[model samples]
Target: MEVSIIIVSYNCKSFVFECIDSIKKLTELITYEVIVVDNNSSDGIEDDVVIRYPDILFFKNDYNGGFGYANNIGLAHAKGKYVFFLNPDTLLLNNVCQTLYDYLELNNNVAALGCRVYDENLNNQMSYGKFPSVIQYLLEVFPVKWVSDNYKNKISSEGYLTEDLDLDVEFISGADLFVRKSVLDHIGGFDENFFLFFEEVDLCMRIKNAGYQIRITSQAKLIHLMGQTMQVSFQKFKWFEESRYVFLRKYYSKKFIVFSKSIFIFRYLFLWLKYLDKEWHKRAVFIYKLK
Candidate 1:
């Protein structure tokens, strides 16, 4: 197979069905297989999906593992040279698989690539970015317009939200990431330590450290119904915060982690006091006791 398209789904049956339909309808000119790993969602996605697409390889876990854990299961069974880790909430707008495959075939230096991602209304979404740092986190907390503008410019320059041309980037979004299986094997796949967010960042960091380039291109496109699978809630915020800490701890020095945690605690406390929202207070307490 040229590509093994793996989708890890949880509690988003409709989105998964639509995503698979889009893949089947739009993707052509590439030899590919579809794999769906269900993280024990309560929805009857297994039966429905199996009935609808008997050819798709489907696995259902007994419990909900994190994104990386579930995808690792799919990776273990993949038989392709490249693995496309696609989110269940995405719809292909073009022959995205063929486009990414062609790009990687030509650019041997790039081990991973993501295509242009858009919202349902066709507005571009952030599809790639620089590796996270304490400095970047601090800048996000600042309220000055010029400071924010400068930060945005830095992201643009570093290839965060490019719209027109293909660019080598520090990391690609997990939403539509296309990666060589060899690089994935070298890095041992996504870090299962990341329960939610930042897994792709960690994977990309490892790939870059292994001397391979990461990139994003505009030659292909997809529509992502952002946050459809993982809705914004306190639990989602908790998972994000936990994964952020995990990522920083893995890649940063002790002093850097200490400074990052201190800044996060201070920022959350400030939000708690300024806004007086119980949610902020809860977050502050949660981070304070995260250990």
Candidate 2:
């Protein structure tokens, strides 16, 4: 096969259906198979999906094993030269799979390629960026635009909306990542250590360490209906914070981790005061005292 498209599905039934339909309809001239790993979604959408898209390979985990692990499951079953880890909330604007495949065929040095990602409303999303550090994470939390502006100047814009075909980036979101299967096999796939966030960053880090560049291309495009399956909730926030800690510990120093936690606590405390959601307040407090 030319490409194996793997989607780690959750409870987004209609979104996944639309995503698969777009793939089937838009993708031509490339041989690809769709693998859907249902991470214990309780909505019974898996049954409907299986009945609707009989060509798709469907598997269900006994329990929710988180994103990275579920993707690892799909990777184990993949049988293509290239593997595309796509989110079920995405829609192909064109023949993105073939475009990415052609990019890899021509480039030869890039280990992974991500496409320009937009929201359902067509607003460009920040889908590629520098590898996260304490400073980068803190800048994201606080609204200091000047500091962020300087950072962007140094590292270049994380969000690529230009007409340039190739944009090199430190990491790309797993939401629409296309990777060479050989490179993935060499690095042993995504680090399953991350439960929700930073898994893609970790994978990109490994790919870079193996002397390969990760890039973004404007030639291919996709609409990511961000947060379709998982809405913003206190639990989701906790998972993000926990995964951030995991990433910091894995890649940075203890001093940096402590500094990040301190800034995160202060920022979230201020946000809690401003928003005044009791549930969010309690979760923010829990995160503050997480260590």
Candidate 3:
């Protein structure tokens, strides 16, 4: 098989069909299989996949295993030369699958590839970016956002190196990444430790560390309606506080962990203060006060 397209779905019956329909159309140059690993979605995803494409491989988890874990499960059964870790809400642009395979085959050093992505409005969305740093994270908040979003600050407007047009990047979003099975086999699949976010960055970083090229394919475009699988997303405000600590524990030294944790804590404090001051927060506060 040329590729195994793995889609890890969670309560997204709202949109999975369209995504699968697009992939099913790619039956031409890309001799591929579709693996839908559903995370126990109550939205009838299992029956939908079976009823719509019975021949398609679908696995329903008994529980909601995180995104990384579900993709790892799907990859364990993937038989293609290349594998795609695609989200359920993402749609492929014309011939993008074939393009990625051909590019990877020609460039043997490229371990994994990500394509240009657009929002639902079809506006460009950044798919790759510089490795995260403490200073950069701080700059993204409050006083710096105005500056970053204005005058086309190369860092903000550029997102994560999209300007180079077909270049190697430090990390690419797993939302739609293509990977050679050989490279996946060499380094193993996504680090299961990452329950949801940053697994792609972690995977690309590992591949690059192993001397493999992680590419962003500008020619192939994908449409990602971002944050579809996510729920309770104001909670994302806490991902840095929680996951950054998790990341530091895995990849950084003890000293770095201590420093990173402090910054993470401070950021969380700032966010909590802002959250508390919001109208929604005042209503909740009033309810609590009445109680």
Considering every candidate listed, which one attains the maximal lDDT?
Answer: 1
lDDT of 2 by residue, 1-291 (tens): 999999988888788899999999999999999999999998897769889998889989999888999999999999989999999999999999999999999999999999998888888876787866655665567647566565553453255454656778888987999999999888898777788977888888889989998999988999988787788887788788788777778888888877877776677677778887676567667766766
Q: Give the candidates in order of lDDT, highest first.
A: 1, 2, 3
Candidate 1, which segments miss by more than 4 Å at Cα? Answer: 148-150, 156-162
Q: All candidates: CA RMSD in angstroms?
A: 1.7, 2.2, 5.1
Top of the candidates by TM-score: 1
Window of ten residues with lowest summed lDDT in model 1:
153-162
Q: Per-residue lDDT of 176-236 in model 3, one digit per residue for the tens?
A: 8899999889998888767767777778778888998888878788788887657654456
The order by descending TM-score is 1, 2, 3
Question: Model 3's lDDT to the true fold?
Answer: 0.75
Q: RMSD (Cα, Å) of candidate 3?
A: 5.1
lDDT, model 3, position 111: 87
Q: Give candidate 2 misplaced runs (Cα > 4 Å).
A: 145-162, 272-284
- RMSD over all Cα atoms, model 1: 1.7
- The local distance difference test score of each candidate is 0.88, 0.84, 0.75
